[model samples]
Target: MKNAIEISHLTKSYGKNRGVIDVTLNIKEGDIFGFLGPNGAGKSTTIRSILGFLKFDSGNIKVLGMDSVKDHVNILKNVGYMPSEAWFYNSMKVAEAIKYAADVRGLDCGEEAEKLCKRLKLDTNKRIKELSLGNRKKVSIVCAMQHKPKLFIFDEPTSGLDPLIQKKFFELINEYVSDGATCLLSTHVLSEVNKYCKNAAIMREGRLALLDSPDIDDDTFLKFYYDEEDL
Candidate 1:
């Protein structure tokens, strides 16, 4: 089977500043891969490169067997992405924003969207600008998962969610993976990775520092980050 994601000697730079350097990794199909790192470690940069959100200086990226840069449109067709920060049209209602997205994707997501809203305790009638940060995150989650895309990419997806809702979110992700989908989770929270991920990668200074099963304890993982800087 082909890998879900592959990167080789990937490098991205901003003039004198480095974004990521020679980063290489593989995420197999049907696997939930955890991307772990301290702040400013380049995790988000790497993700943006994979999503073709920015142009890289060198190297190659493939998602679901398609070139990330050359075939991004089709690649995104099978992907659901949740950014670290959730932003929506401030003037629209939660339901309206979600429905618009689902319609664009050509997915009949009304039933599933409603179920997810209930699970996350989101008020669909609320205006996007009126919702709290946590509620906005909930709306983003529903929009991302409602279409049941084959690949899920979440960047700190649980940031403002309460514990109860976080648990439900993980349950939903597990259910998605059980059906043979793939996931790439980038988070600062180690326990979330330990609870759901099968394999993990640690990034530092825009480079891959470690890649292994996340069986190690949280303290051990923290030890890998000697610097206290936030990425």
Candidate 2:
């Protein structure tokens, strides 16, 4: 299968602090690739680099056959991204924020957005700042999915969502994947990964500790990683 994302010899640092080191991975087109790691393990760093948000010390990153830095504008047009942090104009209502995102993405999916809002049980009239963390997350998901981009990149996507909502989110993801969309998901939620991801990369200390298909249960996967002290 053709690759949707490719990283080779990727390295990044924050002055003296290492963000990522010699990271390399390939995600096939139409694959749900899970990126798993403990805190500070460079998952977000790598994602940002791939999105051209942060400059790396050295490496190559390509998305959809285009260099990330040089082709960022074009790449972004075909990509849908949801960051780890959900940011919005504090005073804007949820519906307004979703509209703003849709406008920016050149999407006119008011009906789809409304359906998602109803399905997620999100109150569209509440100001962003007034919403709880989970509500904010729901808004982000709605915005990201409304555009229907070919590639979806989500960082810690389910952090503040309830279990029921999380399940709904996964179902939505599967729906997208079934339509031949690709995803690169970074999260600490092993259960979600086990359920949705076909392949996963486990990162530790800015490097890959393991990369494998989801052939084992989450508990066994956790035990395997725990047994490996350095990871």
Highest TM-score, which number? Answer: 1
> What TM-score, to 2 decimals, does candidate 1 have?
0.95
Question: Model 2: clashing residue pairs?
Answer: none
The residue-by-residue lDDT of candidate 2 on 1-231, one tens digit each, is 889999989999999998999998999999998888878889999999999989899999999889999999889988888888888899899999999988887779799898899889999999999988888889999988887878999999999989999999889888998998999999888877888999998887788755657655676556534536645
Q: Mind giving the per-residue lDDT tens digits that candidate 1 earns over 1-231?
A: 569999988999988998999999999888888999988889999999999998999999999999998899999889999999999999999999999989998878999999999988899998999998899999999998998888999999999999998999999999999998999999999888888999899998788965657767867787767774542
Candidate-wise lDDT, in order:
0.90, 0.88
**Candidate 1 residue runs with Cα over 4 Å from true position:** 228-231
TM-score for each of the candidates: 0.95, 0.92
Candidate 1 positional error at 29, Å: 1.2
